[model samples]
Target: MRKIGGLLLCCFLLNGLNGQHQVKTRKELQREVIRCINESAQQYKVMMQRLDAARFPVTWYAKEDKLVTSGSEPWVGGFYPGALLYLFEYTKDSALYKEALQKLNVLAKEQYNKTTHDLGFMMYCSFGNANRLAPKPEYKTILINSARSLASRFNEKVGCIRSWDSDPGRFMVIIDNMMNLELLFEATRMTGDSSFYRIAVAHANTTMRHHFRPDYSSYHLVIYNPANGSVLKKQTVQGAADSSAWARGQAWGLYGYTMAYRETRDPKYLEQARHIARFLLQHLRLPADKIPYWDFDAPGIPDAPRDVSAGAVICSALLELATYTPLKESKGYMKAAEKMLQSLCSPAYRATIGGNGGFLLKHGVGNYPRKADIDVPLIYADYYYTEALQRYRKLGMKR
Candidate 1:
């Protein structure tokens, strides 16, 4: 009877949640953004003491009472410094800047690391913002070299940047590769070298052709024959099945194409981004709060774990997409993003002060299928949540 009663109550609450629509005005969002940023500043100051200069934060494992960390070479290394820079940008706290600079010092050597396709995440997010706020010749040089290292992964025959180095015969590209193109695009802008721009375009074009489904949902991974550039398999490692739409994969596509449109003024990328947004917004199972299940097609409906990281990424993308779209669509996009931010700020998702291992948000699913970092606080989740808050405040509530 107890188990049955619990199940009934859970369903009832979810149904009520689905029926509710919460909205926040620009002023309300501004206040929350300030509060969140200030909280982040305090939390990260504590987090800085938990790790030394050589390692970066990954997530906070509350159950273990541990702060999980990674080296500077992984894909997530930059987000620590990137988050610090974002916090520093808003707070102008010398401690935030000093901590970010320390992480960047440890991370700068990744510019020459040609072994991975994640230098964009590792270098650009850290140094790109650093260069933007405080331009340094060395930063520019590091970014250019990082872009060169990333560009070297592109295959002329495949018309895409190889994402993962596979066994002797296969080339693997994941939809996440789209996020890396911004580095290439920025490199071209910085160097006036059309080669980098051309590579970015080719990679985007090829991914558009192969990575997405008819409905704009993307495959997590597509494997190709290295010699002939022909696709051999389409599958997923993080989703429930080979064909299920992983929540974060969709978020990456939406953000990548929106960014592509911003850089190139290309109508197709805009259309692609809009399509992805619609798919996510209109999906039958998407919760009313806008935080989606780890996989859209996961077997457990209304009970699957929510990926707050995906929500943060999508919220940030939608805020940017709202600007470039038509007024009617833009209004919808902005309102949706506002709702997402509100949900993220609520006590259900946002961590309490001095809690969550010094991270800002909670309930992030890094790789659900792999049973890794499940329902934890992720560094990228906080980074993108901070980014979305910044973007929302900048847009304001003029409409």
Candidate 2:
């Protein structure tokens, strides 16, 4: 009778928990979530005051015409200002929204800022999502214009999106393009012309061909025959190019394809996403604590340090995969995600002290050549870290 009563009590608790999301509209739930987001966003604003905006163009580094360093990132700017727009969206704070729009519009006019790798991160992170959530026709116009600007970067010869913002023929493509394609796809949907979607699909298909090896681990960069569109070399373009596997690059593919499948509903994209997920789980070395190295193939971990940012990205991706994946496979992905979230929430990966910036993750390497922000803080790390938490908490409870 005691054991039976315990099981009944558990069932009662579970049912009530599952009811929260079902009963709330997206707007209503987001209202509550925004309360939490604002606390972090306010802290983030204060920290960002330190950055020198002119020098630290965020995301990827650019070419410097000097010898001591082949390239120079030289400073620290990142993609989080756009993320602030989310707080604005949820709160309807006109000031916050306007400030973010101003920043992106200014960035749009920046002639030097032209990397295509993070079109979504740079543009869609604010303006694109703004257009979707708010539906302002004028912002819609800006979003369309941004799409055209992004489409202009597509290399017809390579059939891929160009990245790294360097020389024209030194073409390089990376896994992060999957997120950028959504910008392009949405542009097509918004404009009712197929051209933007066509470019996005072409880039996605091209990546499926050139980036993945037979075993399914990916190359970070592929240089193409710019003149003829032949892939000249498939190199481990980042993280020790000598056959080392980058953990975040792997996560990008896992999440990217899952996202691709969500958009295109193509089985091949889902399979590729699964292939990478299976490889990571099967080989992931769960130390005493469960976070991962920046690179799985990187020698000397625990002592060398691990990247919580990668784990956070993968955790959210796996959870999304769990929702859409077959039931049997879903269990494993959710389990891995649980482990990652547990690791991130722990004292090891999380930022404990105050005023160090609002970023939740530690040990995220931007380019590594640029700086070693060892276990420091990163904005995207915090964004995805919080996302994984919210997703995990609301797993079966959500719409």
Candidate 3:
């Protein structure tokens, strides 16, 4: 009788939480998302009117009130184009598609860039989306080569891809590196190259073993001994402290593991994703709006800057997770994701039609510690926000 009572209590609690939050219907959300995308397309058109092909946007500088752009090799170069592709997919606007292709043309040279571990961000996000939409032969070749470049960074000794080389002596693997595995997985699917799949699995397994706390909150970076495969330090570069949960880092882990599960059908990966989601959702510090503070443990509680990029990422991942889980397990995830989408569509986070420097979402905390791109509009935030809308649209269509 006690066990049966506990189950009933659990169901009651879940129902209460779901009932307390009222989200927009699919039709309402679709209209709002489409309006936002149309506004974003127009904003980009104005911004791109003066942009040189050699530069790509990274974030908006509110103090300067201008778009911050970088060269072709920056990790964030692909996101602008990726967001454009999402807009194109949704609006079927030829201008958006043309601009995205132009940016991808400029971004194509990064396929051979082996100096960095971000080829996935630089190449795959751009070309991979292009291939999915257009199915061009050249895009596949670009992605396959980009995967090869990313694979070149893998060290068997550390059982992970090297994320940074700044320290020279230390082999660094970051939680953010988890986001890159999608490129490798896609490569295996495109070319039947099991090597890419193996490398991705090795990295995911190694990360799962070391990068997470018992509670499943992830550290930002893990430094390993390059020669002996020994962990030297587990630290955070962008989080509040070495021990705190960085909002974006956790989001990356959730999204990455969710993607990993989809690609490999690994139960461990799914469990990990669910665990991380629980940590994020159940944390007391999470704001009522479904967006998180820059760090879960960051000082100032309600005063800390919200990371819309993190929220956008989690929103997209949860929508995908909803499709994969059982109905009972999926209800909360879907509701939470819908709430996030509603929050993002609100005036507080979503930029006005002509504002926010051509970005879709506003007020993302890029790296609070580094004092970089704080409380500004970010390209990746827009990319993932649009991606989430696309996913939600597909789900609604299925219904």
Candidate 4:
């Protein structure tokens, strides 16, 4: 009762401060975040009952009434376990922790796979959270190995990690590669090895040089000649066109550079992250609800499908970016993030408590150019949504 009264007072004070925009107060947002986390915990528990040791939850097709499953080798394999860990940390549910450990066991071998550039998403999200909550030496070793495997893909000539091996003549690096640097940075921190840090910084610098436009919107892919490290082509594999901005790709760049600044304290990375944030927020196509279209430049504006996954990623990035800016800019970033969170928490984007095959979010567009996983619930959306809530709950009342 005392806590409730205190929060009510805080809410009143916040409303008085931000009366110009009619923003949700921190106290109000905190209550909603707590509700979302509690609801997510219950829904995911139901989801776990339907899964086996060998398969992980990926997405749900509501029209078909089906829950999609994937093996542990897919790029999105770790988000389920990572989300489970996040829930477990907050709720202290033993069932959630057990489910995460089982999934991590299946993911452990991927630390040595060395064929993909997503070990950060695969290993770091799962084992990284586990180590933070439980402090296990095995998790540490696994993460370090995963970082090493990711580092093995770095080409010295290109100054970036190879994202795909589809062609022998081309070294492909996507904007998404920035997210994987977190695992490499963690490995350097763990093993006291400068090589991993160097590789991550080199990749960030190279991506900064070639993957962005003058407006700071990012290209989805940049193909380099492997022999000479010269640019071969810049294209988009998942966007509306070769020159269009894929919404999630832009989100990935924002989150990745913000994370890079967090790990390295480099002002260039911070400035880059801020520019990307401004580009997304100030774009003409950004919806009033704060959720973005699948591709900012995708045809049929005002009617394009919204991507809640991108919104979730962007919200998580903005909350972090807010911490690195001055007081006024930080409040602006936080307001934008709060609006995104409120939009995501609404019925339009959130799944009903028991619907959408137990997934938390709706209307995530995956690989739209290929017509894959469009207008569905995505696992990464849930992971980052939960993560953003956690970050917001921690920082929302600091003012």
Please report the candidate that would top TM-score against the real structure. Answer: 1
Best candidate, lDDT-wise?
4
Model 3 worst lDDT run, 10 consecutive residues? 10-19
Model 2 C-alpha lDDT per residue in residues 21-94, reported as the tens digit of each score:
13334344444344445555565454445334332222211122111111112211124545556555445666
Residue-level lDDT for 313 in candidate 1: 95
- Residue-level lDDT of model 4, residues 1-399, one tens digit each, is 995565356334423432333456778888988888888899998888778888988998876788899988988988999999888877899999999999999989999988899999989988999999999899999999899899999999999999998997899999999999999999998999999999999999999999999999999999998887999999988999988999999999999999999999999999999999999999998876688989999986655677889999999999999999999988889889999998787766777777889899987988887889987899999999989988887785674
Off by over 4 Å in 4: 1-22, 397-399
Order the numbered candidates by lDDT, best leading.
4, 1, 3, 2
In candidate 2, stretches whose alpha carbon ends up further than 4 angstroms from where it belongs are: 1-42, 48-78, 87-105, 108-115, 286-289, 369-372, 393-396
Candidate 3 lDDT over residue span 1-399, tens digit each: 995565356334433443455577868887877777777777777667757788898887765787788989878999988988988887788988888899998889899999888887788788989999989899999999999999999999999999998987999999989899999999999999899999999999999999999999999999999998999999989999999999999999999999999999999999999999999999998877788888999986655778999999999999999888889889999989988998888776788766787777877988899888877888889889989988887888898
Clashes of 2: 1
Off by over 4 Å in 1: 1-21, 397-399
- Report the Cα lDDT for candidate 2: 0.63
lDDT of each: 0.88, 0.63, 0.87, 0.89
Range of the 10 consecutive residues with the lowest summed lDDT in candidate 4: 11-20
For candidate 1, give the lDDT of residue 320: 96
Clashes of each: 0, 1, 0, 0
Q: Worst 10-residue stretch by lDDT in candidate 2?
A: 66-75
Candidate 3 Cα lDDT to native: 0.87
